[model samples]
Target: MSPIEAPTIEPVSPERLAEASVWIAKLHGDARGRAIEEGLRRWLQAHPENARAFELATEVWDDSEQLRSVVPFRPLRHVEHRPRWGAMATALACMLALVIVGVFWLQNVGVVATAVGEQRQLVLEDGTRVFLNTDTRIVVKYDKEARRVELRRGEALFNVAKRHDWPFIVTAGDRQVKALGTSFVVRKDVERLAVTLVEGSVLVSPVLPTLPEQIQPTIDAPGSIEQTPVTTALEARKGAGEFKLAAGQRLTFDAGAVTKLDTPSIEKTTAWRRGQVILDDTPLQAAVIEMNRYNEAKLIVADPDAAALPINGLFQAGDSAHFANAVAQAYGLVVIERGNEIVLSGKPIQ
Candidate 1:
């Protein structure tokens, strides 16, 4: 049976919806983002449905950005179940993407992304600066009311222009970070998340009413597997937490409350920012981990004390082989590579 001529979701005003979509794209990728953009350019020169779809897609993108921007992100109540910067689930926003699109079907769209190892820099309407790191994706939300952003995966640094009433927030994992005129870093990793402060102060903590156990994810993109929801490690953020970082301090913690550790050193802490790792008498194992960031594979310390052998110098992030060579020469150790793992010892393993 022919798909009935569905009650078409009447296209909203071109300018208004288009404007709204722009805001949406700022926070989330839209139908017309890459696909639609290419499609639309082709449509304008070729046929009309392409143009119609592109136009409708445009409205969706613009409004999504606009609506969120208008609503603005706020610091969620301290619940502690929030994921840190490096370890947020990549599936949250994708689920909602289809919902937003379906609801506004025959609607508009907006936004952009960077590939793995790619960095993106954006300037918000209020002149705030956002820097994205490796495989990072973000959409800027702007509206008549407020400004906000949705971070999907990877890491980002926010240099915000603080406004007292309209606070700026970064949403990652299950937590919300409120920065009212500050600079901070948020990193999301597989097993952990972190929020680091570079300048000004940020209120880094958990969100209330935690993410329930047994998360059943929705597939938003093709060929992507949904994430299985996991429970927070600890109860509502407990322990002595709440980091008010100064110029060169950073805070890390799971759901068990904030753990403030002095950044090893300026050189060590900010190494990724400069694309360089300068270790100063750090353990071989620790150094190995840092070097592995530039590549894939687990660099294992064969001997417990093998890593205890401290060596220091500058190395690139994720350059495991070169770093291994450097480690061998500097600390009199042998390197062994097996599959995706690297091992260290005084003599190469046979």
Candidate 2:
């Protein structure tokens, strides 16, 4: 009967949120429909909080999902051999961006991944398969009209199942990668987002701030981003996000640029999943991080100059002590572990 602690509320799980989305969408934009919701309804009501909560939700949806790429539900549309299709619309209202992404929402959706130093694989109800790299999580939130996932951290290899109605969308940090029909790899670190298209197309866009007043009355549907399109998706994705990738394309995005490299070989880039960090002239700092992932013994490079020095070779991870010794030997340096840090210097400490 009293006001609830609204702001202090922990965020709802995507699946639960998706269920609420279905309730709001089915309400058909009316007060009576809301009155009939779980709260206003009779003893048939399943959850007592559904009424007031659904009310606040309707406002959120109108302010968020009413004008954008809202679609009704279909499953696994992104990985189907064929293309996925959707009906999207935009409308300008007052000083707000009335963005609505209609979906055939599912009741439960979440993305999950393993903890640090752990790798995992998951299959969604739509049949899409996702391989989460070490310390990664994928969320799946579905509705009667749509399915989506939020990649929370680390990396993932996606083998999307086919669905024409419910396309699979992965929101990773500030970037949104849409898998319309594809198998691809996406890695997200605090500083960067890199994507490689293995077998299909994906639209990788940066998140942009919404300028409510900038909404035009025209049906300004942005272009469809695909994997093979050679346009400057990077520029198109600017402000909000950057770039896209088609099958076989490899793109690495930093804060400034999206570099489209040569076609990719999955086996080469993801060889770490097989237990080794494969480097082709990679930086020393990066190699050290890889070793740290699996090693308890610290590797501290006392000489900043030595760390920047370029080196290339395939070394077994278990032999980091040997590796450090080799690096020191090659650079005419010394390796020593004092306390928690291992120092590699140009002079022998022993």
Candidate 3:
């Protein structure tokens, strides 16, 4: 009789192979204990294929020191029998896949940020120019389907190179502005989001559920209607009360409602791009807030009466001293410079 043939072994899966690579990396680290050994033993005993996958991964890691060198494995501390192996393995597998695909890992995502009183311009891979305003941060992600930018904080102006097939979308403060071949500015503040269209058109929609209630329009708000005529004016497809904006239009969204301002001054709204801040009769408090965005030295209106004073003029961005002096001269407010703060107070009654 022929010798009894051993049971056929199934091939290991790529996922398992990746997981094994992670375990091998961990074992090479400083962590060692009976719990770790027992956990690994259980994993190996769970399936015959697990052992084979681990062996293959180990052999590959041993054979190529260069491949092993690519993985930046951190020293995990005091981790008992948890399934953290899956996460580590997935990371290792991804690194190896990046090597095999001839793609640098960092190339997938890009970040642009500006410090206070600073601005920058970036030309994206799609020939779109993005101008980041002071104290702004943006994450750019380009994929096969679309070019997406997340306005994580502050403001940015996007000059999109039209690609109808690859729509450019900007997400800011619970709102998404989808555009094609348009120039638009997205500003995200602590309590509100503003989108202004310079040219072309864009569809503005709320990112509900994903966004918290603090920033979204509530049902009880007067302007949270079922529809708006602005959508029709822009000739855009509407859904979920999404507002549409054409060139020279601006949409401001707060917790109360979304309001559209028609024919807004494109130059004044976008003056920061030219290192200027143009305020057309803006309230003093509001102007101070705007000025603080561009400068490390802050402007504080200690007097509520002084805070409500109207401000109108063009001032260079980041020129807090000049702005404070101008405000003092214009409104009879006293400007007191203390440390890094410029305090505006009502003048003494004469």
User: Which candidate number maximizes lDDT?
Assistant: 3
Q: How close is candidate 2 to the true structure, as a TM-score?
A: 0.56
Native-vs-model 3 lDDT? 0.69
TM-score of each prediction: 0.51, 0.56, 0.60
> What lDDT does candidate 3 reach at residue 236?
33
Cα lDDT tens digits, model 3, 155-193, are 999989888887888988667988889999999988788
Q: Which stretches of candidate 3 lie over 4 Å from their true place?
A: 1-108, 208-240, 348-350
Model 1 TM-score (2 dp): 0.51
Better of 1 and 2 by lDDT: 2
User: Residue 171 deviation, candidate 2, in Å?
Assistant: 0.8
Which residue runs does candidate 2 get wrong by more than 4 Å?
1-107, 208-244, 257-265, 294-298, 315-322, 338-340, 347-350
RMSD of each: 17.7, 19.1, 19.9
Q: Against the hidden true structure, what lDDT does model 1 obtain?
A: 0.53
Candidate 1 deviant stretches above 4 angstroms: 1-116, 135-146, 150-153, 162-165, 209-243, 255-258, 261-267, 336-350
Score residue 24 of candidate 3 by CA lDDT.
69
The best candidate by TM-score is 3
True-vs-predicted CA distance for residue 274, candidate 2, Å:
1.4
Please say which candidate is ahead in TM-score: 1 or 2: 2
Residue-level lDDT of model 1, residues 1-350, one tens digit each, is: 22222122344334433433333343344232576565435545664434554455544333333211011011112232544422221222343233333322211112546554444445455656676665666666644334556676667778887666566777677666777798878876655677777877666545545434443122234322222233344333432223445566665655554444555464455555544567777766777665565566667777776757665666655566766765665556788888988777774221
